[model samples]
Target chain A: MTMKIVFQKTSGLTDKPTHYCPGCTHGVIHRLVAEVLEEMGVLEDTVGVASVGCSVLSYEYFNCDMTQAAHGRAPAVATGVKRVLPDRMVFTYQGDGDLASIGISEVIHAAARGENITVIFVNNAIYGMTGGQMAPTSLIGQKTATTPYGRDVSVHGSPIKVCEMISVLDGAAYIERVSTHDVPHIQKAKKAIRRAFETQKRGGGFSMVEILSTCPTNWGLDPAESLEWVRDNMVPVYPLGVYKNKATGNL
Target chain B: MGKVLMKGNEVIAESAVHAGCKYFFGYPITPQSELVAYMARRLPEVGGLFLQAESEVAAINMVYGAASAGVRVMTSSSSPGFSLKQEGISYLAGAQLPAVIVNIARGGPGLGNIQPAQSDYFQVTKGGGHGDYHTPVLAPASLQEIVDLTKDAFDIADRYRTPVILLGDGMLGQMMEPVEFTEGTEIRKFAKPWATTGTLGDGPPRTITSLELDAESLEKRNWDLQQKFAVMKANEIRYETYLTEDADYIMVAFGTVARITMNAVNKAREAGVKVGLIRPISLWPFPEKPFLETRDRVKGYISVEMSAGQMVEDVRLVVEGHAQVDFFGRTGGIVPTQDEIFEKIMMAAGGVTV
Candidate 1:
């Protein structure tokens, strides 16, 4: 009997194992991006900026020329690289702590300038790398190390809705918010990533996909429970949809 | 190019362009704003780029980016802006990227006055950023030297794979003088095999990072940087001495203060005072050879500056207490006059306190 292979690893990822904890969805998100790059056939011609956080060592995992950026400065570093090499594809993989807390200014300015680059924003709603501190995207009443009494809007500011905030920028060509809770959502997330890269290939300015990810260890949940939490909790706050599409001018 | 009249900051931009610096990222600050404006108008003409970043921090980081891409990139600012750039500077040094940073000295601890001052002496020479690293600081006293050293800075940066700091003052930035640039000279190029331009699919991917989590690895990196710095010190020490051969007193200064003391030494010579001048061009390698040569014969050395005796510390350190070393400075944006410096020289030699 002859058997056909149904699944294979992507060439866009290196052989190195990731340092992310078990039950974490970062591995899934990385695979999605790597698969998209491999599918697009631009993995050889793309440069990636790995942001500071758990993904800081992502340069070791991505099968492209990579730069490890200082906390929150990946956008600025990508801007420099893309400006110098306009034909090469450039993107930044950033976490919520890196993007929303420290790097908010860099992303805002990159969008304002309409810099031709892609941004992969992973929102786990907590700082996973530094032992589960509260994050800028942490949901209301969420309990973390810093917010032991649960997040209070009276004390801490509201969780930043990055897609909503970034979609309003004139320079942003494509903006979407996706989730990684289940198979269907994960497929949709891959499609969004492909579109963002496609936008960049066609000289679209400032494409971003804010992926609602799961942090099982940090969130005090099992791998299965984390997916349920994202679907039940995060999806309500960060709705899954394309917030902006410059090509269609549709929300 | 033949001699043409130009402002100090414009000279810096044009000289950098001549040196093959096709990319400039900077934020607008007083004194150094002319350099940014000049690059804005000039870089595009040469098919280069000039990006005005949101802040000096972002500007330096942009330079860091371009530097990682193996291009001759530059960013400039005044005192407070330079302070903001310290974080990126440390990153650039830690990553061992080649770039040039210009600090047009101004009065500061805060938003001090916009007038020219040498208050950043300690900040520049003592390694302004946090790291076990040093940047080769180049001090150009005249517009002509600005043309020469600006190009040298780019070359030195690329040669060592390190950031180079070019020190100037508000006087150097705003003043006008005639300068001749060596146009059409072939810019020197260094191959950067380590730059991250994307993988070629034939090799493993390259990662450009400064983070070394392992203690031994980080310590080794520090040692490698120190070894590189030793080579720089040995090969890059640059300074000028005038009449130190048979002088009774040697006066030390740099940048604009050097020019003033030069004139002061000349007038004192006409009055038959045995005075000389020594100006350090490469401030970090802090030219100790001149002091070593004249220390036994000279009665004392006076360090003059636009600030409160910062470089004098180095002068004293180099002299090794062999002779009396004194400091004369005018802080808070005051440019010391030639006559005042000449009188100080005369006072050290004799009692002529004019």
Candidate 2:
């Protein structure tokens, strides 16, 4: 007799089925962001920037006004949008290679300028779209197509801790590193995403949540194995929790 | 505003403000630095936003973002800095965003000297970025035209929804002349229904993107872009002619060199050699209409420039071998003198009959 709605998809995401390979955690991360925006009820007034790599097509997935940016320039593009439409929410969904390598200058200066925007940086430890090339966030001994001999600290250098690096900027209002390894961590990741967006809604300035995602296809592992890989390998190197919180002076 | 003497670079900022440009993002580079500095000072007074970006790369991408957000936005740089902006520019073109880019060109190829050069002619007209797209390039020789074309550049950009370029040189960037902004000039509005302003209510969210994964779709996008370009070429092709009513030799130049060639035209007339000047204002369109009437009458056209014969290629293409296409140029920031161009006029006039 009772026809009531149960749990359903967020309106912040479109019904378009994702192109992500089976087991990749990008879909989960996208859902977290979309759910946060939907919960905040700012999806109608939000602009999302889809960056290069696998996330380059996020504009098609995110059910909001979106823009596809040049490789490594999403933050700069977000800055432009936020500056023009100050009342509207603007954020960039960037991958590790797009955010840490070619786009390092854009991200650093956008933080340094305290541009009123948010960055949802997805760090999968490899260039997923380019078929598993070593990323700027690749682990020390992790082997990708480019680092076929296992990443060597002697030549390849160590991976960048984006949350740690961006946290030090005076203009960065909030910075966090979150993981999607399990149900609990995924819940926490959603909270972090909400905090980043909330920080922007309050004009807190330059918020970023660096998500530790799993690239099962590129990592040469199944979905279950990939979650273990992130928990066993990535968590130790990139510890979870907020690195910088403008709200409680490092809450 | 009454006529006031201002440097060519400063006029660009002043006129842009009058044209209702709400945002300017640029990095400091010599020659064009004054444009950035002027914007820094003036934009705040006009309630506009001005940002000195970290680099040209960041500046152009900012412009791309602003344009996508549906506003009048622009960026300025020199040759070296402009090179850094190429990828972002390509992205803008791919998305068909409206933005203005001012290039106060200097010597180049590899950190070349900061002297004025027209060597960037190819870079401006022939798709400076990697794409099958073309930016409408405006080359204004005089300071007054700088004021006029700066406004026109923004209008053209907004009107066509394409990146419009103002191709100045070190000379145009530095020279001073009287310019007046017409008081209370109404800023024309263009409807940007396709912009991604994040204000879509109940409607499906729009995406401003250039990446079409499907080959057929990308080709269709290219076809649409080409059609827009065709419309722009039809409505925006601009150039000015002088003393060419019955000339035997036509001198072609743009920017500062065009001014010098005008003096050379007078000298050629004084020497009883019928010579004229064709100052191509819209350098990308190449002003083929002017040559259509004079190509048969003139013996040949001499392309004079501060660089080594870049625009001459376009001149030849337009002339179609009906008239000899000669080149008189000095590379590496060398500004050709009035007499130097007169000499080329005289040489081309030596034997050919009109």
Q: Give the alpha carbon lDDT tens digit for every residue of A85-178 in model 2.
A: 9999999999999999999999999998988899999988999998999998999989899999999999999999988888899999999999
TM-score, candidate 1, is 0.98
lDDT of 2 at A236: 96
TM-scores of the candidates are: 0.98, 0.98
lDDT of 2 at B106: 95
- Write the residue-wise lDDT of candidate 1 on A74-191 in tens digits: 9999988888888899999999999999999999999999999999999999999899999999999999999999999999989999999999999999999999999999999999
Model 2, runs deviating above 4 Å: B200-202, B351-354
* Whole-structure CA lDDT of model 2: 0.91
**What residue pairs are clashing in model 1?**
none
Candidate number with greatest lDDT? 1
True contacts kept of each: 0.69, 0.91
List model 2 lDDT by residue over B239-307, tens digit each: 999998988888998989988999989988988998888899999866889988889888889999888
